[model samples]
Target: MASFNEDGLKKKLDDLNMSQQSIQTVSLWLIHHKKHAHAVVNVWYRELISATDSRKLTFMYLANDVIQNSKKKGPEYNREFGSKLGKVFDHLGGLRLDDKSIKGLNRLLTVWEERSVFDADQIRSFNKNFNKDHSKEKSKKRDHSKYESKSKRHKKDVEEFEEIASEPRVRRESELTEHSPQDSTPPSDPPEPEQLIEALQELESAATSDAVVREKIASLPDEVSDVTLLNNLQDLNAARALSQKVEEALAMLEVYNKRLAEEMEARKSVARMLHDYIAYQKDLLAQAEETLEEHRQKQGKVKKVREELKAHLQNLPDISKLPNIRTGGLAPLPSAGDLFT
Candidate 1:
């Protein structure tokens, strides 16, 4: 942007009046930048607050253009126009929105902002700054967790941040639009059908000179006469309807693909658990089989001892046929009886 004295800046704004297309080009350029975009939006906000413009609607229109760019860009350009709508509300908050039209615009911005995907850090800060009403409720729910050691708490925080970073977040088609549409400038009625057809025909024949193309470009401010212009303004409302539809389909497909990945991961976990369980059962079975085999061997040894004792009893002589042998008397005929037997 050209650095301009106060007069120079006013002249530029004046020159932009007859050219809505120029306003859009300039507006999007400024909004895509951080410091410049905020500065531009703030300038408009100040103008609205101070009522500096003789024609306030003119400034309102420009401001609305800024917001509309952000909305159309959506989260796809989040870094460029981060929290710009919230900045507008910085001044426009509270009872000032009683006007029905302002209320409508405000409602539109609120919806757009809700659909937007903000940075996690910025969101945390916003809630921390503005969510005082919930503080009491949170305090009541607070547990002895605060008493935990500092090291453990730090570890927990690190884990949570890692988990969030690793988590698969699904951004919708709306996420592509960074700015909100504050004022929806109705498209000028297309040139009468006859004139449009003439323009189309003119477009078909190649211009022999850059002079003619430049003349056409410079004439009546500026226009996107071809693919370049259409692509440049694709972030705007009607231009994006088709692209946005395509984006919606892609987002849904992304969510489905992520869900399938998670399901597969869970399946792998269950399979591992089953494998571990089977190995544990096998160990127990082996221990039981070994114990049974030991018991069988011990029972076989005991049977062998019983059989040996029975054989020894059968080998002993009968008491009735044997010669008498008392504790104190001699067995005189033992030898003769043995010989007769």
Candidate 2:
């Protein structure tokens, strides 16, 4: 594990042109470490060339070493418990190690610690002891607080119900006092208890029907295990699965379309290359042909000149080199020779 200063790491990366994969890996680690991740990434972009092979590998190795070491350090080293750490790493490398491989790594580390290869066990044990003590204290406080809250809520509900129940009694008592019992009092129907119950039910139903309930239910904790909650969850899961399948199909279709587009682009590129190559070859051939014709015409002119000179020389009488000016002097120019010769 290295004590990496962001400045030092950037300097090292700049010295070597690292790839994007390497940069992203380092940036994510900087994030995992809870130190300015994006700032570090920007620094990397500003400093690193992003083209050097060794630079990428270096960042990747350093990041892996740091993360592994941090995890070994303690729970404080762990980020949000359910964070998608694997996805981050996978995206950086453009490769994925499956669940089994990851589990195997965990198992290997556990075995190594158990074998007393290092002081990992002591550190882990200390962390566990402290965490347990803290958790127990926290739970006790929370439980007592929750108990008080429930008691208060129960008292409030009872008071509200009692006030409601007393309203009808007070009305009846006033009516009886206002008129003598059975003294020519017209019979008036009082609201039935069932009607009140029905109205309450209707109010509750309306409240549940509001869109907010759907949102709240959707946000409920995944750990809920109550039977009704579980049933609703299962139904929701089925709907989600169907939606996911539809989304997957759409994604696959998009990929297919993109691939088709790329293939078409590739074909066009090949065609253009072929056209350029053929045009170049054709131009070369035409130039070569023109040159060959010029060379052939020159050769023919040379042959004609030689024939004329030979005729002129043969026409001259055989004379000793000194005597005949026609034969002894330098041969006449082609134009100076007689037409017949």
Candidate 3:
């Protein structure tokens, strides 16, 4: 029986391998673009499957083999590799294009991130290419006036600076002996975006720029045109907000748990006290009944007529004091077992 089960298991494993190979073949065909093929596969499996299975499973096995084989072929075969592969998928999936043709292509190429088959260097290279290509394409679309405008702005700035230098300087009282205020001095020019940008660019281009100046310019906040910079700031802010919210939630949960623990302890204490009180009452009742039995044993039974007559004479006054015979002739007495029962 065990041999039969083992044989069946081996056959199943073989079938799974065949299925996985078939899937990979279809996947490669579906993924028409070689640039993002590996990335799509990695992301589709990585984020979508459990880690242990990812490494051992036959389906992922074929996908992993394909990526490794592609990497060996050439640098051009490198897609967004590694964990970052998932991010590429995330970016593409977020696009709002509802066109059937575009959507179908996206669906066909859809894959999640898989960490097992990741290659970091390949991803870096991919990003470098993507950025270079994107920048080139954007430059091609822009007008020549954009570059010309920069040169014109620089010329105007130099002229303005020369004009300012030609004007007389305004001197304070401390330097009155050497110079005096000149009304001819042109009004100080207010700073503009173009001026700041030009200054920063010049500093950046210089071979021997001041470290402090470069740091200050680089660290200065960006404008709308620098989407990456703005996005980084927004992401930072969002992370901070999420962290604060998580901390607040954890604090509230801690307080609730503490209150619950205190309530549970109080209830336990009350239960213990009630249990002890009931046991003490039972002990006291038992002692009282034992004492009553001892007194009866010491008295013994009445024997003679004279003793009975004497007892009757002794009880005559008490019996004659009854209120009404019909209403109070007999008050029911409980048996010995009634006390505990």
Find the candidate with the highest TM-score and give its number.
1
Selected candidate, larger lDDT, 1 vs 2: 1
**Winning model by lDDT:** 1
lDDT of 2 by residue, 1-341 (tens): 12346664554455432333333334333433344444444454444224343233333333333333334334332333113233333332332332222222333334335544235644354334324334454466566765566455445433443322222112254555464433433222222335445544544434334455446545544434233443554577775865575565556556555655665454433433344334434534664576589889999999999999999999997766555575667665567456657
Give TM-scores for every candidate, taking all chains together and pairing residue i with residue i: 0.26, 0.20, 0.18
lDDT of 3 by residue, 88-117 (tens): 434433333222212222222222112323
Candidate 1 all-Cα RMSD: 34.0
Write down the lDDT that model 1 would get: 0.43
Off by over 4 Å in 1: 1-35, 52-64, 67-87, 94-98, 114-341
Span of 10 residues, lowest total lDDT, candidate 3: 182-191
Report clashes for each candidate as comma-separated counts.
14, 1, 8
Question: 2 or 3: which has the higher TM-score?
Answer: 2
Which order, best to worst by TM-score?
Answer: 1, 2, 3
- How many backbone collisions does model 2 have? 1
Query: Cα deviation of 90 in candidate 2 (Å)?
Result: 63
Question: How many Å off is the CA of 232 in candidate 3?
Answer: 18
